[model samples]
Target: MTLPAFELVQPRSLRDAIDALAAAPGMEPIAGGTSLLVDLRGARVKAETLLDLGRIDELRGITIDSHELVIGAMATIADVLKNPAVAEHAPLLVEACRLFASPLVRNRATIGGNLAYASPAADAAPPLLALDAVVELRSVRGRRQVALAEFFKGVRKTARKPDELLVGIHIPRAVPGTLSAYRKLGLRKADSISVASVATRVVVDMAGRCQAARIALGAVAPVPLRVAKAEAALTRHGLTVEAAADAAKLAAEATSPIDDVRGTAAYRRRVTETLVKRALLELVEKGGDGR
Candidate 1:
C-alpha cells in the first residue's frame, strides 16, 4: 500500500519539531513511523504533513532518578528490554515488552508510538498502568504530566492534545517486596494482538500480607483498566486461594468485552478470570514476598 502524498519535515530539535507541528494544518508527529505509516497507507489516518521526531536528540534516553525510572518516549521495545534500569525497576513492563511483537517490528516501534496509538490491545498499557506510570507531554505552550491511568480517554483516544508530543514515561522505582507478572492470550505467540491480557503487581510484607496490589487488564474493554475490585481482593486476603478466586471472579465480571475476530466476549471473560488467577498463583509460587 502506498501512503498518500504528504510533506515530511525532519527537525533537529524538539522545539523545531513542535513548531512545525503547530504551524502546519493537518500535521502529525511520526516516531519510528511503525504505526503511523501503516495507518496512513490504510487510510486510517489523514495528514498533509508528517513531522519526523528521529533527529530530536532530546527525545531519546533511559535514566534513573532517586524516585523513579525515566524512559524516553522514543525508546524502542528492544531498548527497554535491554536497559538494566528498566529490568530492575519495572519487570512487569519488561515482561510486556517481551510479548510485544517480533524483533523486526520491535526494533522500529517506539514506546511512545505504542502508547499514543491508544489501542485497547496495546501491550504497553496494562503493565505500565500496573506500575502507576506517568506520561510526560510537551508542546510549544508548555509541559504537563498525566497519570497513565488517566491518559486514555477512550478507544484510539488520549488526553494528549494535537500539538502535544509524548516525551517520556516515568515509573516509580520498585519497592523491596514488589512482585509483578504479565500474560497475554494471543491467538499465536508471535506478532499477534492480544485477545485478552493481564498484568499484576503485589507488594507483600515480611508477614505474608499484601501491602499493595494492582491488577490491570487489556483488550477486553474500550480502554485498558486497573481492576480496583480485584486489587482490593488481593490486598485484603494476601493472595490466598480464596482471594485469588474472588479476584478472578471480579475481574471477569468487570470486563466489558465484545465479540470480535480475536475472541468471543464470553471467551475473553473466561480467559480473563483464569489468567488473573494464574498470575496471582505464580506470584505465590515465586515465594510470595516478591523478593
Candidate 2:
C-alpha cells in the first residue's frame, strides 16, 4: 500500500526543523521510516507532510563525553553497532541492536524513532531505562529532558508533545564497580516482537553482596516496567542461588502481563522470572562470584 500524498521537506538545521514541527499540522518526522512506514501502509498514521531528519548532521552521530554517552536522534542501529565506543562502554546497547529486526530493518531504524514510538516490546528502552538515560525533546517553545522512567506513558504512548522533536539521548555513565546485561525472549530467533525482555545493571560490594541493581522490563505490560521491588530485594543481599530465584519471582510478580499471541500471560510471567534469574546469575559468574 502506498502512503497517501504528502509533502516532504529536508531541514538542514535544528532551528528549521523545530519551526517545521511547530507549524505543520499532521506532520511526522522520518528518520529511518521503519515503523512509520508500516503505520502509514495500514492507514494507522496520516500526515500532511513528512519532515525528513536524515540530512540534519547535528542529529546523525555518536559521541561519548565525560558527562554522558550522547547519541544523535538519527543514528541508525547499524551505526550504533559499528561504533567501537559503544561496544567497549555500553555493550547492552549493542546487544539490543543485534537482536533487532533483520539486518535490513536494523540498518534503517533510528534510535529516536524507536524510543518515540514507545512500543512495549522495543528492545532499546529496557536497556536505556536501566542505564538511567534521558531523552531530550525540542519544540518551538524550548527544550527539555525527561528521564526514561518518566518518558514512557503507556503502550504506544509517550510524553512527546505534538510539536516536539526528539533531539538526542543522554545516558549517564555506569558508575564504578557496575556490571550490566540484557536479555530478550521472542517466539523465534528473529522477526518477532519481544515476548519478554530484561535489562539489569548491578553493582557488587567487594565482599560480593549486591550493592545496587536496576531491572527494566519490556513486552509484558502497557509500558516498559521497572522491577523495583525485585531490585530492592537483591540490593544489599548476599549472592546465592536461592536469593536469585526469589528475586526473579518478585520481578515476575511485578509485571502486569496480559494474554497475547506470542505467549500467554502465565507464560510471560514465568519467562520473566527465568530471565531475571539468569541475568542475576550471569553477573555473579562474570564477577568471579562463588554463588
Candidate 3:
C-alpha cells in the first residue's frame, strides 16, 4: 500500500530537527525510514509532518571516548558491523547486526530507528540491553540520558518525549575477562523477526566464578528484558552446569510471552530455557579473553 500523504521537512542540522519537532505537534522524526515508512504505509501510525534527520551530520558516527563506545543515533546497522570500535567494545552487538535483516535493510536501518521503533523482537535491543547501553535524548530544554532498561516502556512504546530526539547510544566498554554471546531463533534463517532471542554477558573472575551476569531476552516480553532472577542465580554460585541449568529455568519463568504468529507463549518459554542454558555453557567453556 502507498503511504498516506504527509509533509516532509528535511532538517539540515540537529537544532533545526529539534525545532521542527517542537513546532509541530504530530511531527515525527525519520532517519533511515526503514521502519517508519513501513508503519506509515500500513496505516499503523499517522504523522502530519516528518522531520527528516538524514541531513543532520551531528547524529552520524561510531567512535569511542573515555572508555565508552559512542554510536551516533543515525549510525546504520551496517556501520556498526564495520566499525572496529563497536567490534572491540561490543562484539555481541555485531552478532545482532549480522542477524538484523537482509543487507539492504541493514544498510538503511539506523540503530536509533531500531530502538525508537521499540519492537519487542528487535535484534539490536537484546544485545544493547545486555551491554548496559544508555541513550542520549536531546531537546530544546536540555539533554538527558536514559538507561536502555528504562527506555522501553512497552511494545512499540518508549520514554522518548514528542519534542525530544534520540541523539546517540553510549555503551560501556566491556571489561577484561568479560565473555558475551547472542542467539536468535527465527522462522527463517535471514530477514525474519525473532521468535525468541537471547544475549548473555558474563564477567568471570580469575577463579572462573561469575562476577556479574546479564541475560537479556527479546520477543518473549512486552520489552526486551534482563532476567534479574536468572542473573542472580548465576552470580550466587560458580559458573557450573547445575548453576546454568537453574538460571535457565529461572529465566524461562520470568518471561511473559504472548501467543503470536511467530510462536506461542509456551514455545517461547521453552526456547528461552534452551538458549539461555546453551549460552551460559558456551561462555563457561570458552572462558573470557577480556575483549
Candidate 4:
C-alpha cells in the first residue's frame, strides 16, 4: 500500500526542528524512520507533517561524562552496539541491542524512536529502565530530564509533549560490583516480537550480598515495567537459590499479561519467570559482577 501524502521538513538545527514540530498540530519526528515509516504505511499513524530529525547533527553521537554515558537520540542500534561506553557502563543495553530486530533494522532503528514509540515489546526499554537511565526532552520552551521509569504513560503513550523531541538518553555509570544481564524470548529467533523479556542489574558487595537490584520486564503489561517486589526480594539478600526463586515468582506475579498473537498470557507469565530465573542464575555464575 502506498503511504498518504505528507510534508517532509528537514530543519537545519535542533531549534528549527522544534519550531517545525510546534507549528504542526500532530507532526511526527523522523529519525531512522524504520518504525515510523511502517506505521505510516499501515495507517497505524497519521501525520500531515514530518519533522526530519536526521539532518540535526546535534542529535547524533555518543559521549560520556563523569556522571553518565550520554547517547544521542539519533544514535542507531548499531551505534549502541559499537560504543565501548555502553559495553562498560551498561552491558544490559548491549545485550538488548544484539536481540533487537535484524542487522538492517538495527542499522536504522534509533534508540530514541524505540522508546518514543512506547511499544510494550521494545527491546531497548527494559535495559534502559534497568540501568536507571534518564531521557532528555527538548522543546522551544526549554529542556527537561525524565527518569525512564516515569517516561511511559501507557502503550504507545509517553510523558513527552507533542512539541517536545527526545534529545538524549543518560545512563549512569555502573558501580564497581554491578552485574547485569538481558534476555528476550520471542516466537522466532530473529525479527520476531517478544513473548517476554527481562533485564537485571544487581550490585553485590564483597561478601556476596546484594546491595541494590533493578529488574525490568517487557511484553507482559501495558508498558515495560520494573518489578519492585522482585527487586526488593533480591536486594540485601545473598543471590542464593531460594532468593532467586522468590524473586522469579514475584516477577511473574507482577506481570499483567494479555492474550496475544505472539503468545498466550499464561505462556508469557511462565516465560517471564523463567527468564528472570535464568538471568539471575547466570549473573551468579558470572561471579555476581557484570564483567
lDDT of 1 by residue, 75-127 (tens): 99989999999999999999999989788888978888888889899899999
- Candidate 2, superposed: residue stretches over 4 Å from native: 288-291
- Per-residue lDDT value at 105 in model 1: 85
* Model 3 spans with C-alpha error above 4 angstroms: 288-291
Worst 10 residues of 3 by lDDT: 282-291
So what's the TM-score on candidate 1?
0.96
Cα distance off (Å), candidate 3, residue 7: 1.0
lDDT of each: 0.89, 0.85, 0.91, 0.90
lDDT per residue (tens digit) for residues 1-86 in model 2: 66778889999998999998888745788889988889888888878789999889899889998878888889998999999877
| Cα-based TM-score, every candidate | 0.96, 0.94, 0.97, 0.97
* Highest lDDT model number: 3
In model 4, where is the ten-residue run with the lowest total lDDT? 282-291
Q: TM-score for model 2?
A: 0.94
Q: Which stretches of candidate 1 lie over 4 Å from their true place?
A: 289-291
Clashing pairs in 1: none
Displacement of the residue 31 alpha carbon in candidate 3, Å: 1.9
